[model samples]
Target: MYVFIVALLAFVLITPAHAQVHVDIGIHLPGPPQLVVVPEVRAVQYAPAAPANIFFYSGQYWAFANGGWHVSTGYNGPWIVVTPQVVPRPLLFVPVNYYRIPPG
Candidate 1:
């Protein structure tokens, strides 16, 4: 009976340490907080659509897979390609559905 009690106590103490749920998500950083569960599935959509075409999904915003940015009136883009002459800026210059009014 004594051995049984000791075994039970040891198990209770050790089991909790291993009971943790290990979830893998992102790459490991060679530093603190080594392992982390990157439940962020959004970042995975980097190369989702065609570089020149785009479509909205899930709820968050999405952009075309185009090697370069584009400008359009709506999701169905292909309009005037935003250039330095169009706006003379980065994200601000674009005019596609991706281009939203600055919140200020």
Candidate 2:
């Protein structure tokens, strides 16, 4: 009984943080983008399988998800929304098919 209560309390406490990890910009992408190693970041993926995947560039991480764009300083994000015009052009040009994850 004690263990169950502790587990429940832990879940309740952690749920909000877990939820924040995946932000929804209001648009749902059909799928994630392809992983590419762009030069801007040490090794960044252009697109991700999860619509809200993060890409590292310079000293920040960029996210293209839910029809909007956001940027953060770390992989786990407290993302700030940006307009389409602000998004990197190369990311916009990534082929549509790159979002898919290949079958094993």
Best by lDDT: 2
Per-candidate TM-scores read 0.21, 0.46
Tens digits of per-residue lDDT for model 2, 1-104: 99999999998887764233445444344443344675444344654445444565556667766555687665545577777887776666544454333212
How high a TM-score does candidate 1 get?
Answer: 0.21
Model 2 alpha-carbon drift over 4 Å, by segment: 1-44, 47-51, 100-104
- Encode model 1's per-residue lDDT on 1-104: one tens digit a residue: 99999999998887765333322222122322112111243222222222222323232222333333333333333233333343323323233433222222
Computed on alpha carbons, the lDDT of every model, listed in order, comes to: 0.33, 0.57
Residue 101 error, candidate 1, Å: 23
CA error at residue 92 for candidate 2, angstroms:
1.5
RMSD of 1: 19.7
